[model samples]
Target: MTAGEDISVRRKKLRYRAWHRGTKEMDLILGPYADAHTEALDEAGLDRLEALVNEEDPPLLKWVMGQEEPPENIDRGFLAEVIADHSARLAR
Candidate 1:
């Protein structure tokens, strides 16, 4: 996002990116998650999510699938929330 971009625009762009990752698995995982939660995110939360979506597929897939931990620079707390949300949906 550019400096001073509108939050709603940023949200829309993030949603698009989340839903359109190069792989089907990532698209499925992140598309619904973004749909459910992106509107509620504050700027900092969006920043965390942007960082996550910017990650390459392999490591991100591992992290989201609980097969590996994200690096220390990643926001574990926010990721936990995303994981929990995804888990809850799968349970339903």
Candidate 2:
């Protein structure tokens, strides 16, 4: 596949995984966020998102919901953007 096609395929796979996370709560959170933003993400953004999604749901959900902070090693700025975006969507 061409490089563009490969990236498109990877984005689609990520979106699918986001929408199908085992828990309904995670599915709702990540699914819409992925649908709205994954296409615009650069490689580094995608890598961060992939790492976020790979994390266990309990801690991930806690972090996203603002109930707890993510580890310092995580890309907190990007995750903050995600949370802000999600919050904005909810406000509309």
CA displacement after TM-score superposition, residue 6 of candidate 1 (Å): 0.8
Q: Tell me the tens digit of each residue's lDDT in model 1 across 16-50.
A: 99999999988888888899999999999899899
Candidate 2 lDDT: 0.88
User: Relative to the unseen true structure, what is the C-alpha lDDT of residue 14 in candidate 1, on a scale of 0 to 100?
Assistant: 96
Query: Taking the tens digit of each residue's C-alpha lDDT, what string does model 2 give over 1-92?
Result: 99889889989999999998899988888889999999998888889889888888889889998899899988898788878878888899
Best TM-score goes to which candidate?
Answer: 2
User: Which runs in model 2 stand beyond 4 Å of their true positions?
Assistant: none
Candidate topping lDDT: 1
lDDT of 2 at 15: 97
Task: Return the lDDT, model 2, position 30.
Answer: 84
Q: Distance from true position, residue 35, model 2, in Å?
A: 0.5
TM-score of each: 0.89, 0.93
Off by over 4 Å in 1: 1-5
